[model samples]
Target: MLADTATIVARLTEFLGPDSVVADPVQMGSYLNEPRKRFHEKAAAVALPRSVAEVQALTRFAFEHGVALIPQGGNTGLVGAQVPLRGDEVIVSLARINALREIDAAAGHMTVEAGMILEEAHRIAEAEGAMFPLWIASQGSARIGGVLSSNAGGVNVLAYGNARELCLGVEAVLADGRLYKGLNALKKDNTGYDLKDLLIGAEGTLGIITAATLKIFPLPAVYETAIVNLASPEAALELFYTMRERAGMRLNAFELVPLIGLDMQMRHGMLDKDPTAGPSPWYALIEISQPKGAKGGLLQAGLEAAFEAQLIDNAVVAESLADRTRMWAFREQMSEVQSREGASIKHDVSVPIAAIPRLIAEGSEAAEALVAGIRAVPFGHMGDGNIHFNFSQPVGADGKTFMAGAQPVHDAVYEVVLRLGGSVSAEHGIGQLKTALLKQVKDPVALEMMRAIKQALDPRGILNPGKMLD
Candidate 1:
């Protein structure tokens, strides 16, 4: 049988003092209230561990008593991975354990505690004349552990790859409180099984990540950014291929935006001014990172070639820092502006780079057929083929009524995604939200392997129980 809330709180308080343990329901609001405000289950307590040793101790007690423990970082996760699944579980927040363990700018690697904020990691790397190039929308609030746990892919994923690729090694506490001291700066070590890769995107079901050694690169000399007007997704695709061919790996971000995004932002006062070159049916926010000591004007040259090929009709290349900032703001605020419009059903899925245009066209048509006047706001990292396909409710429809019909909309979108050989969940890791969907969509053998690995590592099923593999 599981321990009650009082027993859990008293034990946690004994382990980490009264100040670090928050058992009062009213005091635990921040931890309970996730970003989406979707899951409403209350946690028994919130344990803030200050060091690695404290985390191990907490895990030890939870394992012995068969208590569920949820590992949370900044709580900025769109999916409810970092939030409580069961009301009886205790939340372990890593916000206080943030610290830099080691750094070597010349070596191009740094070891940081899991709780370190991603934006702070960027600043630290910048101070050393280098950069940790994983740029995500929630970098300001997302912590290193949570980012790695989710294997987060941000805008710059086209150039820098995701969190799993950026990390060289990680230190974690296993389900039974045994420390897995895997922290290292090795670029290659084919000695044994790739344990680091297994734990990264596991959503904390296997273990609690404590620290990681992350890759860093030399800071870029200049960023060439532009918002190019396109006729449709086809034009944007052609433009993407052209720019990538010209810039190669330097082409970092290629984001797609619809005209509806701009209109909604304008209607809700989200942007200071229009950032695109007038208006068009579609827009592609493309950026190229030029290293120090390299010649500039690659983006401009590529754009001229694209114009010649008739891939883009008009474009606005950012001439100043403010211009670049505003252009990025337009892309970053795509998700936020949807809330102002009304109820929205969102899907973060990815497909092969070649199939993006078809995915958008067919998916939108299918959704429109399902719900008349459902505004399809499909936009995101076009360079990497991960579109945050979302649909806003009809202008005059009731929010609750539209949301009630969300399952059909989701089914329609996922059908198109799967038919085009795409993924159901791209950047957001499966928390409690998509467990059943995972079972249905994932391969049978793959699920078996995952279960075996979970059982081997977390026999007690104490670390982030009822998550990922549910």
Candidate 2:
């Protein structure tokens, strides 16, 4: 019983008010254009709900009318979860639902609306002399709902954990508009089923997250940062073990970047100057935090141990604030700089921390064998074993031509990842991009349980239809 586009839009306007609905396709650009320009199906209309009650009302209407509702936040998700897959679906933007309901820095938690910008959440925590450690490249525009929905992992995940761990509870609207008011900030509550965990990473397929109780931490006094040159991913892995043993929880970030990434950034002038020591086959960017009243220089001491073990050769420790910023810029710019090179094949896969070295080595070898002269740019959270395994097109190769042959490369990488007991997706959840891949790689039993959960929660399939399970 799919409703016509005009009928749906008119009904939405009738209840949500004409000003809240965007019926014209052109004005819906902001909602449809995802981080990757890959998903392009036009939404029937974009609904800007201003409150949780409104979101519930809209969900109920869509459920009854048999209109699919795609929950959206800031439209910054790399996967196509927040955008429409089929043209008949409605894009329900939660951007206007932004609100800060409560804050208790000493209690180590804050309650915020889903539409609140991630960076703003950071500011709110900092204002109370605390910190919300969840950080991604798109923090400026990414909203809380999208971040929790994706269960996003950022550079600091080594110390703080991903969104699932960071979130204490969530309040959401079900497919039939019933409110699941689970936004309690208790540190320990094993009362019943973990519904908060389910909705946090469902990619909006299970329910629409309206607001959440997110964990916050005390601000560190200072940070020690460095960029060390490693000979290979194997060396980087060894160095990571050393840093973890030495720094413990203070070791916040351990990122890996290849020589090609630095070269691309240099070629595109993305950085003001090179951050690492010149001409290394691979580099490891490390950072350890110094808490209030704690001594610094732990990282320097650890690096000395690494050098004594012959784990690293040359290193450039950040001498000032500018130096540290530049060092991080080098790691964060890895994804952006790839666009300047040409078409690229990207995979956000993770192996067991021990298998990361083999994963990188074998995956790179396979891709090189697949496309002669293909530039292998494997980099990312070395500590967590989540590599942003990516490959640039061969020099002078047409971008479209290289992208055309991406399927085999993807298959090659996933085969290595799976063989090494790695997940096809690490931090980034499976949206429309990897649903097909998930079907092949995921265990049949696990798949069945996931489908059962979705069917039970969203029987009508009106919430993010044809996503995740499908």
Clashes of each: 0, 0
TM-score of each: 0.99, 0.99
Give candidate 1's total backbone clashes: 0
Candidate 2 residue 84 C-alpha distance from true site, Å: 1.2
Q: Each candidate's lDDT (Cα)? A: 0.93, 0.92
Give the per-residue lDDT of model 1 (tens digit) for 1-470.
45678988888899799999998899999999988788998999999999999999999999888999999999988889988887889999999989999999999999999999999999999999999999888899999999999999999999989989999999999998999999999999999998999989888999999999999999998999999999999999989999999999999999999999999998998889999989799999999999889999999999999989988889999999999999999999999999989999999999999999999999999999999999999999999989999999999999999999999989999999999999999999899899999998999999999999999999988888888888
Per-residue CA lDDT of candidate 2, range 98-157, in tens? 999999999999999999999999999999999999989999999999999999999999
lDDT, residue 171, candidate 1: 98
